[model samples]
Target: MQVSEFHLTAYSTALFSTWIFIEELGLLFDAGDGLSAGLLQKARKVKYVFVSHADRDHLAGLLQFQQLNGRADGPLIHYPADSGSFPALEAFSQRFDPHIRGEAWRGIRSGDALPIRDRITVDALRNDHITAPVEWAKSLSYRVWHKKWKLRREYLDLPGSEIKDLIAQRGRAAVSEEVATLMVGYSGDTPVEDYGRWDGAKLLIHEATFVRKEDQDRARNNRHSSLEEVLRMAAEIKIDQLVLSHFSSRYSAEEIDTTIRRYGREFRVTCPVYRLLPGQIHRDVLREEPVWSL
Candidate 1:
């Protein structure tokens, strides 16, 4: 449906911390520094966390988050299977908080899909954010799908009584087909390569770490997307809304917004676009006035 339905509360900056809480789904993307302090009581609602990578900025707040919200059936933490940092941190969290124990940690790889809540599934996709082998699970992006069963096309025109009879004769599975709608797409930290990666996603939360292409290219140690690259792709894709985050501390809010508004129009991006300004917590991002739209 709409992002407001998810009630996204988030805080993100490129080099410091990043975390997005989807209130409706009980889902948290990333666990960067200040997650507990920023969300406070709201943090208790997070039952599942999907970490994109092992970068310190992406998962620096895991200990505090788990300590406060964890119970015997504690929250589940999912991370890239090949990322070494999470295992160590998991062990430390267990030893550090013996009383508040049982934070289940799962290492997931690309193409794996996990059901986080009823009728909702989160699927992982590998991205080129980190250089590694093809099978390595070093970095990832995620897609959340909301699934429902609809009457099969062949049965849609039939009478309701007949459909019920058919269902009684056969089964619900035989009468209906499963359909999934892309509710949200998350690009944790990645360069813009696949223009259609987020196509049909209703709400896309992506990282735009650099305002300039040159600046992003200069940092060869890791990969990141610039504002223009993301907006240009947004223009070409079919996302209902876009939320830009993980902005660099180097750019002022004015600079970030100005560039977003400028390229957004230049690329003819039609979707309502919102941004999480660096170092600030955005409560209900889509409810806020959009920075760009046509």
Candidate 2:
């Protein structure tokens, strides 16, 4: 599936709440405040939810979300393995919503892959947001991959009839191989590092909490990325579309847009770049006019 085909809705403001919903996949990244209120009926359609960290701003909405959509069969919630907060929340949710049984709470770590669809998988990657011990898993990013098939190199040049015959004789697996394309990458509140991890994705949704290096002091604990850092990373990567979120409330829309344009020019970034303004719930984020369009 194409990343462009998904309808992405998001509301992200640093320290308040941050969430992104992919309507097509029924997938959600982070369940921050107003998640249930913002998504409303669409919240029920979510079959998979991934929480990046235990930060209150990242998971405060899970209570309302679970109250509305928790079931005994689906809508699994995934979180960092070493985060005790998720288990506590799950327990509280169980007690608060005694009738909901289908909600499965799972803890995952870096390199874990969970299939959300028959051919689509979400893989977790450790991020540098949390400063826990080496063995502790507290923060993560995710990448979505779509399975595709192609004729094996050895059979690529074969005639149609020959390929058909081979397929008939040896089965499809023998004639073709399965390939996966990185459809989307979501950097949930992470500093811009390891550009290779997100490169080549069709869509990259990352955080730009600070627009300037001087404003880094605004974050007291977890490290955050600056707009300049993100732009520099974007310039060096091979992403098709970029969606930036989790901007601090200190900056106005005009200032954020202007900075994005400035960095786009400085970095010679050609990809369309979209940003979620503070306190606003962006609907069909990719469909909206990008702040810096080539």
Candidate 3:
């Protein structure tokens, strides 16, 4: 079986993906430039697209992606329905409606499930921990699923239970189930508290803007997670593998690695820590190896 993978790109000091494979189909998250275009072409071979957030770094190359791929019947563009926060997405929808033809852009929120393929599910999570306005909070994060692969019997229906609980208690809901062989978490500017809610992710793809503890104040003020914060989250969740990215240009590759190693030692966790530098290309070797048995 050909292993599915996740590709990363740089845009606005953040990490973006050209495409991610769930089941046999490809889901395009955020699009960037540089190596992103090449990855997007590779992703087009698969079937669907899912835009996680509306930030420029996340959606910069989306228009170009649509233009290059042209139009073919597939899933409707899945994104947050909040028009106020995602103005660019709304404009893109109107401007490119002719060439890249799509069904209505389905608005999603925390708890919504989007079926990507048979048994594969994508559950939307709110990006509220950012301290941004509610309108801007529409930036959706996701948790994918493959029911048959779940080891715990209760885990199969946990998403629905969680969503129902959230809605009944919170009075609002937007979660869905899409078939997913892997559970990857994308934090488009999420804060530390948000990390607590994300449990059992095999690979946690998160942002780490600063490398030093001195920058902790700045990271908090900016409402972004620092390298330490990312590591802390990884330790808290006990994730099998942690991919730390969205680094600040101030730190060199060596510096980032050193910082990660220093903090990683304290946590005593064996999960490998990886960084995403500008223009860096990361292939999913883990998919080929299948190290995590759970």
The better candidate by lDDT, 1 or 3, is 1
Q: Write the per-residue lDDT of candidate 1 for residues 1-294, one digit (tens) a residue.
A: 455566889999998999999998889999999999999999988989999999899999999998898876758999999999999998888788987767799999999999987888999999999999989999999999989899988898999999999999999999999999889999999988787779999999999999877888888776899898899899998999999999999999999999999998798999999999998999888789999988
**What clash count does candidate 1 reach?**
0
Cα deviation at 152, candidate 3, in Å, is 9.7
Q: By TM-score, is 1 or 2 better?
A: 2
Best by TM-score: 2
lDDT per residue as tens, model 3, 1-294: 222244433233554333333324466554544424556546555355566666555656555665555454753567776635455665766676665655345677777887876776777777753455765436666766655532234434666777577557755423333334446666655655655556767666677777776776755556567788777767766566666656777777778777787778776656766656534565543433321122
C-alpha displacement of 84 in model 1, angstroms? 0.8
Rank by TM-score (best first)? 2, 1, 3
TM-score of 1: 0.96
- Residue-wise lDDT of candidate 2 within 1-294, one digit each (tens)? 668878998999999999999998999999999999999898988989999999999999998888888877678999999999999999988888888868689999899999888899999998989887766779999999999889999987899999999989999999999998899999998888799998788999999999877888655565999999998999998999999999999999999999999999999997999999999999789889888977
Worst 10 residues of 3 by lDDT: 285-294
Error of 1 at 222 (Å): 3.1
